[model samples]
Target: MPILTPEERIGQVLAGRYRLESVLGQGGMGFVMGGKHELTGRSVAVKLLLPSYGAEAEIIGRFFQEAKAAASLNHPNVVDVLDMQIDDGEAFLVLELLDGQPLTDLLEERGKLPPEELFPILMPVMDALAAAHEHGIVHRDLKPDNIFISKDLRGRVTPKVLDFGIAKLTEGDSSVETRTGGLLGTPHYMSPEQAQGHKNVGPSTDIWSMGVLIYECLTGDRAFQADSVPALLLQICTFDPIPLADRAPELHPAITQVVHKALARELPDRYASMEDFGGALFAACREAGVVLPATLEELFPQHRPTIAPGELSAPPPPASEPEPEPVPAPLAKKPASKIVPMLSAVAVLLLVGIGAGLYLATRPTPTPPPVAIAANTPEPTPEAAPETPPEPPPETPPEPAPPQDVTHRVISEPAGAEVVLDREVIGEAPLAVTRPGDVASLEITLRLRGHVEQTISVTEESPEEVVVTLPRRRSGHRVDPVGAPALAPR
Candidate 1:
């Protein structure tokens, strides 16, 4: 039954209600068919799960999960879930048909979206995610492919969030949960917690994915990248994203702050909720002077104004003629003798003012007079008083010097490991690591592929040269420690 092509399923009736009329779309899971309600003839989209997946209880359960999750959130920015059914072991969902394209297609067509075009579309997505989060649902797999930019009959843009298939319910709802430490979501967009396969993934996980998507939308590139999936996941778990300032320096600082906050490696440091994330982003957009639609209705009004081609190129209407200016009457000339005396008086006053200004400007700043010691103040005891040597004998002895900075020659058994001194990466081992003289001790962290990370402290009393032998990781792909400096994106 799974062998049939999408065309073969056309003209077939599902549960004697939705009749598959045409193939709307297809994916690895199954086909999305344009259908009509048999009784009402209402146009609808039917998402048919591939017959092979019907026997896979997990997949079937998730199929129904998407329906329940999406159906529960009746938001303008979220796609509407109509009905779901399983007929002859073929599970499917009914969704409202959309007119436009997925955000993936738009990004492909136009490499980078400018702030003016991006905020309207992006803000709504944030709002939709915020609504989903309110219901304790986290869309773990949010990416461009899951964001559909739909157009109403009037042709106004209204983005709808799609594909809640892998969504997780955080409130212990009836939705199926991903096994503990099971990895899900695309490699590039996974949060640190997701890459570590943490079971307690929450709203902050979605915030991380949104940050990646936003970074890509602003600068046609992924924030984190590597050659392989495991390598990418490791990068996501450990490394910081390529800085937005480097990717697109022209972007406003407010926007970059929001992005970095969303992409924070530590969950506690990240936005607390989708509302906070969206509010910060929206505020940043406004600060950057990027105008956004107040609401979906305002964005996609019931009736949109249209202009003809001729009107676009037509000349504007002419203005009324201006009145002519009146000519000024000639003034009587003043007597030469009277004018000379007045000029001389004016010159004398100007000279006096100039001399006064120069005198004030050239005056030197006065030194403040020393204050006399108070008569009632207590006198210093003989032991407390410093011996002046009766005169300023010789230059004052040099003040006791501060603790000298210590430089340690650090080397790992496996050379070329990343060496971090006091949380700041100082070249790779074998390297001369330095610590501030003021600090009592310095923390040194060494990391190398396939080995467990090793951290040691260095102090003035410790040996100048230090050596560490790292043990091999029990698992080849161990989750690396996060909060390192961001690796520049390639």
Candidate 2:
């Protein structure tokens, strides 16, 4: 057998699609190469398995298995697989070209991470896990080496997950999603069930691993440490990791609660879903006053119960009716003397009324005289029409459009700046922001990641269109301007 030298590997085209440019890296499974598409000229990363590993049935199966697993997912955080093939008995998969370092290498260079530092890096991974779990997929091996951190077109930090070879497709009748388990995952991050080689390893195992990873990120030390892999597995199976607060006293105490809940040994005691675990961790971070990107808000959407459009709210309880006011007792009967006097007056009045009527009826009736008619009545002339009043002279000439407010197109030199008017976000640049009608001038603020925040006042003197150059923010100085979010995270 002959060794595959770097010179022989470079400059070769694969499947008439990707042309190898250079070797990016090498791992136990295979070596990855930087390649470009021959037709579209798009940059790509090509991972080819060594013939020695390809010769083994299990290694070869996992290589092709990675293709199928990654191909099944369609998420921003998961690496995109462009093509997969077997050439001359060696298997290789083509993936999207990533422009950043792996999380493992990053942790090595920069030891422990703080809340503000860890938030943006961990959020996308949580979102990716949530998305995968939604589709009955769980990444059994989720360590730092598998996570990649990169930046997007807007200079926003992005975290992507790579290598889904050992990922378990969890869709079956068993309560535990997986039945094929033999101490899967690294010893330091594996759950008790996984360490014991139980066939019923489920999503909680992933949650447990994430908790261990979080602790490591915060302390730069593994939760469980031992001299040998076997001893480490024994500790993970029996003992609980030390509290995070004890390890890093400066860290927020709320995170300790999150770590405890997520790393609970029992499935029922642990977080039920990935969304729950991730949301709790971020929520704890927020409470501890950590500076997190605004995009983290989307991770925990309010679960509003589904109601039909025509459904109506229950009617208010019927108002209680007031009882009728009690009537006063009738006054005592009037005296008999007063009653008799009244009766006498009534009789005399009735007799006088009868006599007057009789006299009027006896006096005879007089006859009305008859009218005489002329042979022909002359026609009367028609009346003249009434005149209409004149409308007031045309209202004072036309009035001009009100100058109460004006709109200015706000733009940044590098563009995509989040615009704020009087502390309220209007939109992202290049966008039009109108000054409020009540205020003559407004404090317009423009903010972008990796750029200094600029707040200026827009008055009648300000130009209709304005552009401000934003200086790049130096490393270790994360900017969180008050306005809108510059990036929409996965």
Q: Which has the greatest lDDT?
A: 1
CA RMSD of all predictions:
29.9, 18.4
Steric clashes per prediction: 0, 0
Give the winner by TM-score: 2
Q: Write the per-residue lDDT of candidate 2 for residues 278-383, one digit (tens) a residue.
A: 8887778878888775555555543212321112122223358666799876656545788789999999999999999999999989796897877788889899
How many backbone clashes are present in model 1? Answer: 0
Please report the TM-score between candidate 2 and the true structure: 0.61
Q: Could you tell me every candidate's TM-score relative to the true structure? A: 0.57, 0.61
In order, candidate lDDTs are 0.73, 0.71
The Cα error of candidate 2 at residue 260, in Å, is 2.0
